[model samples]
Target chain A: GIQVEQSPPDLILQEGANSTLRCNFSDSVNNLQWFHQNPWGQLINLFYIPSGTKQNGRLSATTVATERYSLLYISSSQTTDSGVYFCAVEPRDSSYKLIFGSGTRLLVRP
Target chain B: GAGVSQSPSNKVTEKGKDVELRCDPISGHTALYWYRQSLGQGLEFLIYFQGNSAPDKSGLPSDRFSAERTGGSVSTLTIQRTQQEDSAVYLCASSPLAGGIQYFGAGTRLSVL
Candidate 1:
């Protein structure tokens, strides 16, 4: 089974700040996704970057498949972004069952 | 018709009781997954269903956990003789196919007392 590790288990920031979260996997993966679990417990998909980079509004993500690492960036963060960010991956040979990282808990104060 | 939907948004049961959680994936989606998220913890994969083939239950934590998909559309995860350790948010997600982006449901919060 592959192992995924997320950096900065917990993070706190004031509104209008910026931050970056990183995820490292132990094995090659065929699928990678970033998710944000809001206070209401909804796991919202933030990105589906197995490789390359993608951006959606104030959020952006980049995955370097060769390096087995991925990053999620939040620009000018808002209170609405306060939640847990998770990075999940599926190994190349597996049946696409995701292996999740411990996650980075983000708290944004207004 | 839209994103994934889960039933019984919240559930509370005795430690020795059995409980069932249901998930309805988006139409035409061929892949469905079940995951468990504990408080202040990460998502734990539980099961995977693809099309009509037999489900992959490798992620199930114990023998008491089982899931089934009917008509390759809806899925039900049944936990028998649930224990306190089973208390967590049960999340369901669907994707167009394996290795694709997943759309998650709001999740069902289960508490076994």
Candidate 2:
């Protein structure tokens, strides 16, 4: 089984600030995704990046498959961005099961 | 459905009772997954279904838990003789294909007393 660890278990930021969260995996991954769990407990898909980089609005993510690590960036954060951010990955040897990290709890203050 | 849909958004059951949670995946999705998230914890994989077959169920916590899919569109997770530790949010997700981006439902909040 592969292990996934996320850094900065908790984070608090003022609105309009920027932040970066990191995720490290023990093995190579075939698929990786970043999700944001809102206060209501809905897991919203943020990005699907096994490798390389992608950006969507104020959120962006980059995965270095060679290094077995990924970074999620939130820029100009708003109060609504308060919630938990998770990084899940599917190890190359696994078919469809995703190993999830403990996640980074983010709170954007007004 | 536009996305994964879970039934009975919340459920409350007494100890030793049985409960069933339903999930309807997106149209034509070939992969469905079940996950559990406890308070202040991360999600844990429970099972995965590819079409009508489940290839990975190693994540199931105990034999008291089971799940089945019919018509490759709908899935139901059943827990028998539930215990207090069974209380958690059960989440369902689906992907267009195996090992692809997964879309999750709002999840069912289960409380076992």
Candidate 3:
């Protein structure tokens, strides 16, 4: 059922500013993740990038999986990095299940 | 606990009564998942164990829902007669195979009044 489109669903920065959350998946995926539902929900497991770059510290990710998209980069931003920022995948028949998107609701403001 | 250990973080059943959510994986995990987040939506795909056998329950959201997993490392998600949209937040994850990288827990906020 692959179809996860997450973009500027909502965001508002200030802390240090620097955001760029985007995940677009409609097909081809072996497993690509980037979660961080903090603010209590606790899904935190940022970046699993199914391809290419990856960083942690200030958070960083980038998966191009043949243009299926995946990018979550929240640099200097703090305030506990706000919340909501999901982007899951596992397409390609999806056995172990994982298909979430409709997220990206930052809001950092110290 | 080394991660992925959900239990009664919160639950309040009533509607039809019959709730049982538990999960504890992460000791040589063999893939286990079950998600469901409602309030703001996103994250719903409720079932997939690979040790005690459960080949993608295909997001259980019917038949009053059900789940299993025994000696392979605990897992139970039963919602027999519950309603009220079944409340929400019931996540539980673990992965050490079958498309690894999953580790989550700190969920289980049923509440079906």
Best lDDT goes to which candidate? 2
Instruction: Please provide TM-scores, in order, for all candidate models, with all chains considered together.
Output: 0.96, 0.97, 0.34
Worst 10 residues of 2 chain A by lDDT: A90-99
Q: Chain B TM per candidate, please? A: 0.96, 0.96, 0.32
Pairs with backbone N, CA or C atoms under 3 Å apart (clashes), candidate 1:
none
Every candidate's DockQ is 0.84, 0.86, 0.31
- Candidate ordering by DockQ (highest first): 2, 1, 3
Show where candidate 2 strays beyond 4 Å: none
Model 1: per-residue Cα lDDT over B5-79, one tens digit each = 999999999999999999999999999999998866668889999998888888899999999999999899999
Q: Could you give candidate 3's per-residue lDDT for residues A16-66 as a string of tens digits? A: 989898899989988799888888888878778899998888888989999
lDDT agreement with native, every candidate:
0.93, 0.94, 0.86
Stretches of candidate 1 exceeding 4 Å from the true structure: none
Error of 1 at B44 (Å): 0.8
Q: Which rank order by TM-score, best down to worst?
A: 2, 1, 3
Candidate maximizing DockQ: 2
| lDDT of candidate 3 over B1-113, digit per residue (tens) | 68888889998878998989999988888888888988666678888888756458878879789888888788899989898988998989888887788889988898888
- For model 3 chain A, the run of ten residues with the poorest summed lDDT: A93-102
Query: What fraction of native interface contacts is shared by candidate 2?
Result: 0.82
Name the better of 1 and 3 by lDDT.
1
